[model samples]
Structure formats: structure tokens, C-alpha cells
Target: MLAQTALAGATSFRPLRFSDDGTFQISIFKDLHFGKSKDLVSYNNDRNSITVLNTILNAESPDLVVLNGDLITGENGFLENATVYIDQIIGPLVDRGLTWASMYGNHDHQYNLSAEALLEREQSYANARTQRMVSGHDAGVSNYYLPVYGSDGSSDPKLLLWFFDSRGGNYFRELDKSGNIVPQPNWYNKTIPLLAFVHIPTNASLAAQTVVGIDANSKPGINNNVPLAQQGQGWCEDGTNSNDCAYGGQDIPFIKALVKTPGVLGVFSGHDHGNTWCYKWDSELQLPGVGGGNGLNLCFGQHSGYGGYGSWIRGSRQLLLSEEALGRGELDTWIRLESGDVVGSVSLNGTYGEDLYPATPNDMTHS
Candidate 1:
């Protein structure tokens, strides 16, 4: 029972619900860096990225699609061509009559390009579910949530999907007087489950990699040859040594707020183009005062675009949530490569980190 409202010739999505089979599936396409330029090479890359998206969407038929972040390379765009990428990026979803939501990534902000412009373009499509701040609100653009209702037609929502704009790159017009941004309000019910989507990986996310290494035989996923560009950390090239960068603790407040929140099943991030794996956030990560052993999983979506700086085979991460499994806070996720093969299949539960999963094959490995 998909609900929609007509708004000036465009349909507005409302009240997302699970299927009659009591299941909901979400496909995440992260780092789809489109619109780098109008050159032939860039055009071909964008087309291939779209083909990958179409393949996965047709194969999975997911209930929702998430453009996780870095949807465009803002620095490569101008005011005239910046937002036109939104149409090409969302074309597949619209063609299929599927709905979607997005978060702004580091590269999404630039002197000429902005998250506000992107959101405005996205909202023009009836199936686009991306949201922005109201008149009096001052949070970053794309910081919002959508509720998912159960198949049983109840007024109350069964799950919530939260989207946060990490806010990076050169665009910095909107800011609070205090220079601090609160991603969301405290209006959610603690009893209901929720999942978070943000572009930049938190500091804790890098910590999990050391605890859960990418050993193909056991823990699976590609390892970025370069150091992870975490939140509050500059690019690897900006470091003093230029070879090794240091992590700044500026993102601590956001991490603390996220871990302290209740009913967060998992947090998904995309910034590092070569890293993709999920690990539990436990006391070993060293966020003092923040509860760490709460069965929360920090996962990364596979690099899904050709425009980013990576040779990794493009693919999208798929999450399957069952209405029956929600009570136990269980979720199953895996990466679906462009070749149509599934890898890194793991169930995010109590024993997630210790769990074994298939590794990325040699042919699909990131160079």
C-alpha cells in the first residue's frame, strides 16, 4: 500500500509500508560520483554506472533505493551543470517507478554546487523522497527521517530511516550561531528500530577495521590501499608527511550523540571508496561514557560509481529487513556486484564481527 500525494503535478511519497509478505528491502548505491564532466570518458563512466544501477534494481526489486553520498563531484561542476546530474542519476529509479532518498556527501558541496541545489532538483521528481530543513530549522540540508509502516495497516510506524548530511567540501553558507549542527531532533520513539545513513565514515568506523580485518577467508571486503579519509580528517594529501595523515577528533560529538541514541540498529557510511565491511561497535573502540556493547553495526556500502578514485568493481549494498525479525533487531546484508554475483553476505546480530562470510573474489578485488 504505497501512499502518495499530488503536489503541483508531481506525486509526494507518504507512509511507506512493508510488502504483503512482511518484508522490506533497501538497496544502497554509494559514491555514485556522477557529472564529473561532459567529456566522452566521463559520459561513458556515467552510463556504465547507470547500467550497474539498472541491473541491481531489476535483479533485486528493492522496496527503497538509497543514494548514500557523493552523488556528484561538485568541484568538477558549475552552477549551470551542477544539478543536471540529479536527473541522470535518478533516471533508473524513476523509470522503474521506485522511490528513493539521498544524503549529501563531502564532494557534494563546492563554491558553485550545493546540497540545497541538489535537494531542490531531486524534490522535483514525484518519487524522490529526499528532505530538507523548514524555514526556522537550521540543520544541514538532507537531514531528515522517513517512517516505514508495517504491512498490517497500523497508524504507528514500524521502522525509521534517518538521513544526515555530513557537510564537507567548499560550500559553507548555512551555519548556526554556535557553529554546531544538530543532525536530528529527539522526537523518535525509543522502542521503534531505526537505521542511519551518512556520507562520511565516523572515527569509530576506522577503529572497527583494525578489529575486523579483511581476510578473504574469514572477514570479507576490499581494503582501501590509501588511508581512510574519516570525518573531521583532511585528505591524505593534506597531511604534514603527505604519506601518512592523522585523525582529528572533531567528529567526537556526533559519534557520541549517535551511540547514545536508542534503537539504532546500524549506521551505514560511504566516503572511503575502497573499504566495505561491517563490524560491531564495542568497548574496544574507546568512546568513553558512550555505551558501546549495544549490538550496533557500523557498515560501509561498496563503491558504486566509476567517477571516484578507485578501480574497485562497482556494486551496491543490499539490506533485507523482515517484519518478523525486527523484534530481535536482526538484519541481513550483502554486496551485489555489477557482474550480478553476491559476496560478503553476513547477518548483523549479536555475533556479527565473529561471523564468517564469503570474500570478494580475485577478479572483483579492488586494485
Candidate 2:
């Protein structure tokens, strides 16, 4: 088992565990894009985003909530007001007495706003479980893990949750003085079932969408409108060519690590606002060096905020992990919209991609 490090100076944290019924549910709100401005339009959009959060929280009552990224648009943020957006975005979760973890998005790094400032603000709340596990490290502030114990009250954890900081934004603080961007080491044992969350999707995710073709009718999700913007936008793997269609490939190492790791059920990401579908990474479409899809599934969280670009009705992705299901290497997930409708429900198991789901509810027509 990996060493469980408590947040420095943290007073108390709500322990995460399955219920008596052996189930733990998580709701993921991605790309909230709050605090663009204090204008009436931006204010209303932020308000609507909060409403979506509240609606889904009341509906799913998930054991943990994940603010996947882009909690604020840092370009419009000033030093005096940048971190305040974190307070507003987390208000809904705190009001419901919910615990949450946050990941920093590409838009979150700016002159005034940063992952450090944002994490500090989030950690100020007693209910916020966001942690900087490796202090004084440049791996970004949100890199940490949480253990979910079994319902029977044993000390051993039945499930492990991993969070990564797909550091983005204008600032390049993640790089060390040597200019090397350190990759996170494989830290968990293969025995426990693990789930990972990040803000920006990796190259594997983009490759999956490209190969599968993002169509709601065929893929079992809503709003396949925009193309996925990966972690590194320009520059190819060779690190020479700019404007290469092959992508920056900086995230290749991360993707390779995940694909090779065992017990990784699925990787959940939030960045492509218009795309929200889960695709089993096909071995045939694996990138240049990354081998074996290994039954790892790639999923996008619903765009839960009104501040972002997309017009899709706001919603959050819900995940239900049961002890019995974990024994069978299976997971259940879906999108819970603000309208109180459930869509894109499916099981992530051996036969995941082949499984049929209820037709995605009409999202474009509603909003």
C-alpha cells in the first residue's frame, strides 16, 4: 500500500468509505470556467453553474464530489479576485456538507491565478479534501491520492482514488529550474481497483475519440460537438515541428504510464466541453509507442458550468462504485443533468464498449 500522507496542518477530514450497502458514488463537475468577469452575463452564468451543481448534488448525493478543472478563467482574473472564484465555486459543495477534490486546468494558470493559490483557497474549507501531498515539489499542487475503505469497517482500503494536475494556463510553473517536467511515478499496488481524475484529457483520450468517432447515437453520450483539445496543443513528439497535426505529445509519457498500469479501471477527464462520452481505448489505435489498451476506458465529464463555450445543457458525470462490482472489475456511471434527467448510463466491464445504452436525452433541444 502507498503511504497515506495527511495534509499538513489539516485539522480534520471526513473519511471516505462505502455505505452499509457497499456503494460509493462520485459526481464530477468539469470545466466550471467561473469568474470570467463580474459582468451581468458572467454573473448569471456563474449562478446557473451553481444551480446545476446544487441540482445534481441533491439528486445523486454522491459520497465525494470532484471539481475536475477550469474552475475559473484566469485571464480575466486579478490578484485580488482570482482566488475568490474558488470560494464561490465550492460554495454549493460546502453548503451540502460534501467533500471534494480539485484539479487545475490549462485556463487556471495566469499572472494573477495559479494552482497554488487556488489549492490554498480550496484547502481553507474544512470540507475540501484537496491536498498537496508532495510538498515543495513542482509536480503541481493537486497531485494526491485518497483511499476509500470498505463498508465493514476494516482498515484496508477496497478502492483507491488518484488525482493529477494536468497543469495548464499562461504560467509554466510545473517545469523545474532545470526545465524538466517531472512525470509522476506509478505509486499504487495492482491489487486495489483504482480510478483517476484529471482536468485536461491525455493524448490517449484524443486518440480514442478520433478513432471511435464522437457520435452520440453510436458512442452513448451527449454533445459530440467540439474536437478535443489535448494537454499539449502544438509541437510534435520529436519536439521540433510547430503546428504539427500530430500534437505536442508531451502527454505521451503520462498516457504510457496509465496504459501500462494495472488495476486502472478508467480515466475520467473534463476539458472538451462539447464531448461527453466514454470509449474503451482500442489497442489498434494506440499511439506510436504506448502499447496495450488493457481494457482501460476513457470518459469525459459533462460540461457542468455555463461559463464555458458550449451550449449543451449543464450536467455532471456520476460514478457508482460498489464493493461487489469491484470484486467483478466493473463500474456503473452516467450523466446527471440539471434538468434532473439521467442519460448515457452504462456499465464499465469486460463488455463495456459493446454494451448498449438508452438513447441520449435531447440536450440541444432543451437548452
Candidate 3:
């Protein structure tokens, strides 16, 4: 009886729910870039971000909310203020009794707070999916999977949700005895609308640009080697030139997992604030000799926070998964601006002609 009581008393994770129509809705906001700097402009920007977040939350009324990355700016060097930013961003979700999740970005650790510390703060929220389960790798925290079960409360999951920490650039540590400071090895590299949230893009992200069909916006200011057109409106900074980006260099295995996972409709990230393009990446693209195979949809969430640097209009990405679409191995997603305009959209599985994939909103790619 004592042992049974102990087991029964343990807390359990609440499985994600779907709407009455057997469809699930998710609103993903990235690069919130929220900061609490003491200045008129900074204060106003933070307020605007909060208002936009609330507006999107009320407008879409999604089943789940994902605050992708760069959720907060840390240039102020104030660690205590971190919680303040999280509270402001998560307030809408709490009020509506909605479940949400988050990931850290490259700038998130600017104020000396590590990603692990940030995750600890987010775990305090009752509805957050940030359980502190160790990922057993050097990738740090923000590595876990959430299963979206059927609305009937079945044990079998209908869809899988993945979150990865692309980590901020490496900070310099003290030198070793041999007059050299060997940096720690990069560990985490990995994501999907089958969806992921990461702060930095991987080398695979850079390679995907060459193959995607989307007419991505151009940014001439970027200085990366991939050329201005391939930059996709923002710089595609991967781990190739930067040693602090990810572990095991390019993290090809991580990217391959996203391709191998079944029922994965897309993978979303938020690092390049100005880039918001979605395209397909097959195994052949990752490994030239592999040939063509089912690929994963790679997408970048629109910049939603005012704290970051970017001249583009800010918005969030919304994904709709209907039971019929899921049965047909398809999902629908689009970018919804704070002004309530649908920028671009696509059908995940490529099977068009249904009410899900309207011609007006953009379609990512058919696999």
C-alpha cells in the first residue's frame, strides 16, 4: 500500500489536447528580443512586444504556444530581470490556461545567465513543457520531446513535438597551463512541424537554401560566404566558421534525425531575425550520395520581438493540424502578423485541393 501510494502521488505530465474537431492548433513566436533596459525606447519596445504577443494569442486561440528563441535580450547584463521578461511573454498563456514551451537563443545568455538558468526559470510556470530532464549530451538544456496525444486521451501519440537548444556563441574561458585556452566542445545540434525551436542555424540550414523553392527575401548587408541571395533576408550563421555554435562540428546526425522521424510535417527555428522562409531538405541534401528521400520542412519563424535589430514587420507562425489532414499525413501552417495579415503558408504533406491548403497563402513544398 505504501509503495502504491507513492506511485500514485507522483506528478504526471498532462498530455496535449486537440480541439473538438480532432485538430490541433499551435502558435509559434520567435525572436521576441524582449528587454527591460531603462530607457524610453527600450521600455516602449518591450511594451509593443507584449501587446503583439497578447494580440496574437487572442486572435488565434491556439492549443499550444511556442516561444521559439531569442525570447529575451541580455545585453543589459542584469540576470534578475530575466524572470521579468519571461513573465511578460508568458502572461497571455497563463491567463488563457494554455500550455506552452520555449527554447534559448544566441543572445539569451548575454547578461551572464546560462541557458540552464533560463530554463530553470521557465519551468516554474504550471503550463510550460520545460521539464528539466537531462538530454545526456553536451547540448545543455532545452532538449526534450513532447507527445501530442489524441483528444480521446489515448496513450498513443498522434504527433511528436521536439525542442533543441542551438546555444549562444561560445564565451571565452580562462587559458590552460600550456599557455592555451582550449574551448569546450560544442554539444547540442538538432528540431519540426513535426516543430523545433533553436537559436542558431546549422550547416544543413545553409545547404537547404540552395534547394528550397520559396522566393526568400534578400538582405545585401550580410557578409556570409553563402552570397546575398542565399542569405534569405538575414545572415545564415552556422557552426562552420564559428566554433561555439554546435558540438561535433556540423551535427549532421541531428539533422538526419529530423529527416528520419515519421509524421514530422515541419521544423521551425528562430535565429536569423530577418529570415522567414520554409523549404524541404532531403537526406540527399545533407549527404550527397544518399539520393532523394522524404525530407523535413525547414522554416524560420518571423521576428516577433521589438528588442532585436530588424526593419521587417514582426509576426508569429501558426500551424493548424486537422484530423483529416493528419489522417492524410498533411498539416497546414502560415505566418500571421501582428496586424492579422497572413503572409505565407503551406501544406506539410503536399496533398493539396482540400480546404486546408488554400492557394492564396503560400505552400512550402510538396514531398
Candidate 4:
């Protein structure tokens, strides 16, 4: 049914370009559970997760690659084997012409396809811009926004990348019995220092992991514990209890539009397949009765496929940025692994303490 005005008077998209050393790398490949059970050992573990996503895009030569959702593993009875595991998870980012985008995991339309058939197989990929649901409340469908230009390639954009579609399942409904689900309000417009990629991790990421806590590759307190996602289910809240996939925790106006949007600084997710961390949501920890803004940064991603279930170890999540680190508004992230080993080296908007490396200043250009 896909046509909610198919982006009516569409605007915004066709920006994300930056790399003649002005920098703008990103890479977050999340859960890739590929065809849940299409056998042949799940297509040889999604072809060894596309050879660990082509050795991290030929060693981090990224200017974008965020198939940040489950990238397949639907319950398939053969919707063309979910388009052959979504063309083997975007055939190594379309054989390296690279510039990519995607989001939507709740087992990505669980079985036989239908998040408008994975948004019509990612709009036949010409490096997918990933946006849909022209209006609102079809619950979710990869909300848009992706501008990053600058290195004299400007038409206005220093950096900004927001993509939401945290939908997969659970249709909240419980106005009574104290199983809450009443709060709802939203807003968004103009923001920078941003970086959001969703596929479930709201509930203000469990109130920013209860004011900055869980990190050594996550999952400590809060009952939405990651990995295999069944013991209470990963983050987000409100609990009407439909076997707790922890749905969007009543969303609270998209977590108050990510704490009043403008300069968000962080917010990344992936259906908790053994959580990799990056906390700090401190705007003085609100949400006690829900309402407040200016707290940003909350991360998770590093489950880079292998057909999910997590023994930990598969990786992804990178970032980078530049143009004098976005003119010192900060950016530079990490997580690599798949045996290349880089690990949680944070610094987006500066300091959440992981391993701090910081030093890649040579490329500079912004005008």
C-alpha cells in the first residue's frame, strides 16, 4: 500500500557528500539477522556477514553505510526469500559505490515481508535515501533528514544525519491498569551536531541508561537487557506486556524531539544484540514524570550481523566527521572489530569515556 503521498512535496535529501579529505565517515551495520531461517546456514551466515562487510568497507573507507536495522531475518515463507536476504544485505553496499542508508528492525517486518515490502526493497537502491511515510503515525517508516555537505560542496550543510523508523512490532494500547501509554506530543526542525539512527532504543534509551551507566559493552541494569532480546526485551518502556519487546515506551514525542533537536550530538541504535555502549543523556535526568530537554547522547550498535543471537564480537559503528571535527562541535567514534579490533572509542560531542584516542587533524575545509 505504500503511498501516503509518497513524500508529497518532498524536500531534503541529496546532500550527504563529503570526503575529499574534509571527512564524513559513518558505518553502523547492526543486526543483519538475514532471512531468519532460510537455511544453508542462513545463507552461509549472510556470506560471512558479507565478508565482515567487505572488511569494514575496505578498511573504513566510509562516507556512509548505515544499514542500521536488522537488514533481514524475517520469518519468510519465501517472499523471494526476502529478496534473497535483501540482495545479500545490499550486495556490499552496491559493490562499493557506497553512500547508503536504511533503518527498520523489529526483525524487519517479521516473516514474508511487509514494511511496504521493506520499503519496496529500499527503493531499488541508487544508494537509498531511506525515507517514506510522507505523513505521520503509520507508527514509523524511516523518517528523513541527511545533510552533510561542506568542503566547498555546500548548499548549506555542515553535518546532520537523522533517520528514524524505530518500528517493528507492538501496538501500544493500555490507557488504564497503570500499564501506561498516554503521553504523546512531538516536534522537530533545524538541528545540528546531530547523529541519530534508529531501530529501537528509545525510552530515552532507558533514561540514558539511568543517567549514564551501563557501558562495558552494555546490559547491566534496567530490565530490557540486550542479547537475544527475550528477557524483558531491549530498552524503551511503558510495558503493556505483550511479551515485552519494550516497544517505544510511549515515545514521549520522540523523546521530546531528541531533547529539543538542535545539535543533538548522539543517538544511535540497533536492536540490542548484545549492546555496545555510549551513555550520557544528562540534561539533569528528566522523565520522572516525563518532560524536559537538552540532554543528548545515547548509543548502541556493534552487533553487525552474523545472523544475530550475539556471542558478542561482530562489529561496526564508526562515525568520524572532521571539517575540523565539525568545527569543534565534536565527532569521532569507534567500534570496528570482526577481528580488526577498534572498540568503543567515543568523542561525539565529547566524552562519555570509552578509550579516547582523538587525533586526526589534517583535513580541514568548510565554506
Candidate 5:
């Protein structure tokens, strides 16, 4: 039933991307489950995630910022309550200067520490020159391949990021047992290409299907056991069991292993909470954000959809890429909202069609 495309059925709102010779402008904020803010929906903490990150860094001052994931809904599910809300809300946006990167959802590793106490809780919540620019496999890791340069992005052919993990099988039962839902073949063979990141969303990253057979080998066993499902319950896609891992998992082998491979460009995720957004596997380009509202969004205000805390506001968008888009098309994510001052753009490529949100004060109803 996944039909309704234009940013995949636009509701919560988010689709920002600019880089077609436009120099820079990166602002991606997903699943700000900032320590479950007080559940039962509209969840937000870390002071409402730093007051919605200082009102979107002073209303879009961004050069770059990607907090894309349930940055801690770890609650009683544990991992030190999602590393104390990532050491107080995503480590101070990389200590103030911004230009950041982080990915992991399904309540950021829910809890359960082994694998050396989850690698010593990922080295006491990494962030020291972003853990020495992703140490290349260890030396106090932060997962690697950052490069945000235009002077500041450190190094390594700049702008090629990949911070994947996507583990969290519902804390072994509502969050803990040393957390980990999936995606760990040594972090999937140390992913490559120009991009990568996951917090969950690899049921072949949804093109939606599986009425029966071939939907990435349908399975709801997510490598075994369970969390919270029910869309046909055997991981949908026609389940009769046989080792179900949730129909089309591992996002179709992690997008067939990095879109086109060489210098990969994009791939990001953040559980499916609500106030959603998409563009799962971009062969090159088409990098989008925000998808946290499946819990049950009672309108923008979220009664509980995706557990709440969903906000979206934009002013511009339109990427139109293609330096031969890695694997030939599928990466034109879109989103823009400003409402009254007049601004609108929300085309999530279900074959494009949004002039930009609902209009008049950027209204898209819902709430």
C-alpha cells in the first residue's frame, strides 16, 4: 500500500539539498528523539534538542549539519540512556562550529554492551576532532570517511561521508540486551563510495513490495527474534516464515553495495518515526533527510506517530543532478517550506509534483 509519492506521500516534511554548482548548504535533521522527551508522542529533550537546534541554527545559517537519527530514545532501554543523549544532544553540534555528521536510529543501539562493551560505548561518546577524523578502523573510532571541506572539512577527497551501523533489534526486547537490530558484517565490510549512514532502513530501502517472493528475499526475522512490526507481520512481503528478516532487509544488500561503488555519494537513514522524508539509495547525489513518524503521527503535532518531535521548515530546494547519477537516475529529493512569507517545494520524486508544501503560511494540514 506504499503508494503516494512526492517525497513518498509528504506529511511531516523535509527535503533539503543543494550542490549543483551552488557551492554549499547542508541541513539534515532526522528523528530527533532526543532521549524520548517524555514519550506518548512529540518526544523531545536535551532541552527540546537544544530548542530545535537553536531554531535551525538561526533559521538556516547552515554550511552543514546532519543529526539524522533517533539521537537517543534510549530511555530505560539503555546504553547509558543513549549515551546521555549523545553527551547532551549530539555532542554540542560537534562543539559549536557545526559541519557535523552522525547516523544511527532505532534508538541508537538501544542497549546491551558486549563486543567489548559496545567498543567501550563507542569510546566514551566520540568527538575529539570527530574521533581523529574517523580513525580508519580504530584508535578510538567514530566510524570514518568524513571529508566536508571547502577549507574546513578536514581531508580525504573531501565531502565523501559514510558513518553506518544501523543496529538495534528493539533493545533485545523494548531496548537492551546490548542492542543491535542489524547491519553488522564488520560494519558491512567497511562500506565505501562517496557516502553512507544508517539507523535502520534497508528492507532494500523501500521501493515497496513483496506481495510474495523477491522483495530482497522477504523476511521479518531481521536476523532473528523481533521488535515491533505488523504490516502483514511476517515482515510483510508475503511471509510464511523461513527465517524472516523483514522483507527486503539490509536495504537490498545496502543498495547493492554503494550505488556505483567508486567514490560513493549518498545513503542515509533514521528509523521510520514520522515527519518523514526519503531518497534511500542515491547512486550519486539525491541525498535527502527526515523520516521519523511511523509510530503514529496525529498531524504535524504527532500524537505519537514515530513517537513525536517532528519539525520541518525550508526556503529552497532543487538539485537536478546527473554527472551520470552513479546508476542512472533516482536522486532528486525535494522539500521547501516557509508558508506565509510564501515558499513551497516538496517533490520527493514518486515522479515529482509539489510546488512546495501546502501554501499560505506553508500549511500542509495534517495537524
Candidate 6:
């Protein structure tokens, strides 16, 4: 069931419940941005990322590993950079037989590659079938959703995972092409158990329209329905990187529409690295952590660019959720370093989850 509330100077989110009957383990991270610029990919960072990734693969041996987005940097617009990064840097793991899943980020598509060029890049991968692209879709469409069912392929299923290609699954596409962003719903929504992944945060709830809660400053910017920034979320600092979406503009609307559909156990996202607290999104306020430190049936995700691999942002909540934990009405969602050490973890706050507002005439709503 869902819950809600609102306040004068506060922004809230709807909470969710994840099933506790299955043993599902997952590893999620984003913004590796390999091949972006020589300066960005120093040996130290690369080696650090490699160490952390290797540790995660060994320690958790999770049923699944999800690289949220921005796996490679395509600044100069070379599809080969993406290819080389994954193939040489990460593809080695594929040969070692590690089951992993990935999503496309804005950087990957920002390169402005032609469809033919993209096809060639896809061809480089042996399991290209597993990867789905949203290049040649009609207007207002990016990529379709892919359902992930547990660890066992031909046996019992454990969890239902939904991977959305936000940013239209590519960076800014040509006008004729659907811009960078995806999560297309051509046919009706399918009925499947799901924990969704989007690249951005929605936005401050509609009620926040009049209220500027907690250090909230009104910056000048245009926001996309997803996490992309149209103008800019807030004011930029002197000489700051203003090229990216400052906030998850339309994330709020997307969540409301998705949750209303049912079968959406929870939604996990990356994009916002600074704010990483587990809170219950409701009509009143967003409560941090699980309901009583003993909640279950739901969880949210995030953490991008840890300054280095094997590390998490300061003030971020670390978690570890497993099937056994969920069965006990506990999701082993833990926060840890890239080195695979459990730094600090949050207990599930099983408060009933709900969307604070649905289609309210505000920024995050009615996108």
C-alpha cells in the first residue's frame, strides 16, 4: 500500500515495500565515465575503480551488478571510446563469467554518433543482444524497459528488476531523433515485479513550489522530466561545471505515474551524489532510514563518482540487502566503500510508502 502528506517548508516522497521472500543481491554504482578525457581517467582512478570493482565481484558475488550509467566518457564523440572502455577495461570480467547489467547515460549519447556508427559499436560486443539502444525511435521515445528476473536464468526467479534508459538512453540526440533519454511505453505497461533505476532525481514536490525547505535555494534553470537540467536547477558557483542537469527535474512526475501503475516495489536512482539519505517519501515529510530500523519490502539506491572507486560520498547512507534479510522483513541494504568494507549502514524504516502528490500543477508534477 502507498501513503502521503505535506508540510509548509518540506519536500516529501512516497515510500515503497519490497518483498522479503527471495534472496536477491545486487551491486549498483554509476559515473565511471571511462574514455571521457585523458585528464579524467588517470591511472590512479582507473586502478582504484578496477580494485573496487574486483572486490565487489569477489566479496558480494552479488546475483547482479548494475552500472547505473556514464560507464564511459564520449566527450570527443567517438563511439570507439565507449567500446574501448567497456571492452578493454570491463569486458575482461565477461570472459570470467560475471552476470552484470548496465544502462545508458547522457554522456554516452552526447557524442552525436550516427545510427550506423552506433551499430558498429554494438557489434563489437559479443553479447550485444543483451544491450538495448534507443537511437532511432520516433519522437518522445527513447528505449524500452528490460526486465531482470533473479540470478537463475532457467530456474526459480528471485527478483524483478526494471532498468529504465533515462536521458532517452543517450545524450542529446538530433532533433529528428528522440533526444537523449528513454523509458518508452509503447504498448501498455507490463505487469511485472520491479525495482526501477533512473539516472536522476524527480524534483522538489509540488507543495515545495511556494516553500523553500532546508537550505533550498531557487537557482535559475530549466529542468527535464528526468534528471536533466534544461536551464539549470540552481545558481552556479564561480567557475563550476554547469553543463549537467543540476537536479532530477521530472523525476517526481515519473515516479508518481510509475507507482500508480502498481507492481513497482521500489525505485532506485543515481545522478545525485551529494544527497544520499534513505527516507520515507510521504505527504508530510521524507523520513530517513527504514520505518523503525526494522522495515522491509522496499529500498532506494544511489552513489555516483565516489571521488575514487571503493569509496562512497561523505554523509551518504550505505546499505546491504539480501534475500534472507528480506524474508525476515529485512532488506540488507548497506553502504560501503569501494574497497568492499561496510562503512555505515541504514536500517529499513518500514513506514508505509506513498507519493505525496500526484499530477499537481507544479514543476516535478504533471511532467
- Give the per-residue lDDT digits (tens) of candidate 6, residues 51-95: 556655565545456666556554544644445455533443454
Candidate 2 worst ten-residue window by lDDT: 1-10
lDDT of 1 by residue, 12-76 (tens): 56678998999999999999899877788889888888888988887897889999989998778
lDDT winner between 1 and 5, please give it: 1
Model 2 RMSD in Å is: 6.1
lDDT tens per residue, model 2, 1-367: 0001122323455579999999999999998899867799898888888888878888888999998888898778866777777777777776666788887777776655666888877777677888877554436567788999999999999998988877655553345589754232211111223689888777777777766565554468864644577776654555443554446557766777777777788889888888888887766575776765877888998988888786887899999999999977799898998889888988888887766666686465122
lDDT of 3 by residue, 1-367 (tens): 3223322333434678676679998888888877736688877888888777877877887888888877777656356656666766777667667778887766665534456666776666656787545564355567677888887778887777777766553332334689553333332434344656555665456666545333433211111223212111222234233325323334555655666666666667777765676666654464442234365666677778877776566688888987667766667777877777786676666532222332232222110
Q: Which sections of candidate 4 miss by over 4 Å?
A: 1-22, 27-62, 70-80, 97-104, 109-196, 205-240, 243-264, 268-285, 289-320, 330-367
In model 3, the runs with Cα more than 4 Å from the true position are 1-13, 36-38, 135-137, 171-195, 211-213, 216-249, 283-293, 351-367
lDDT of 2 at 64: 90
> lDDT for model 1, on a 0 to 1 scale?
0.75
Q: Give Cα distance to truth, residue 204, candidate 6, Å.
A: 5.4
After superposition, candidate 1 runs with Cα above 4 Å error? 1-12, 134-138, 172-193, 211-218, 235-245, 288-291, 362-367
What is the overall TM-score of model 2 with all chains considered together?
0.87
**In candidate 4, residue 128 scores what lDDT?**
70
Q: Residue 282 of candidate 2: its Cα lDDT?
A: 60
Report how far off residue 81 is in candidate 4 (Å): 2.4
Off by over 4 Å in 6: 1-22, 39-43, 112-130, 133-158, 168-193, 204-253, 285-330, 349-367
User: Which candidate's TM-score is highest?
Assistant: 2
Candidate 5: worst 10 consecutive residues by lDDT?
294-303
TM-score per candidate, in order?
A: 0.85, 0.87, 0.77, 0.31, 0.27, 0.59
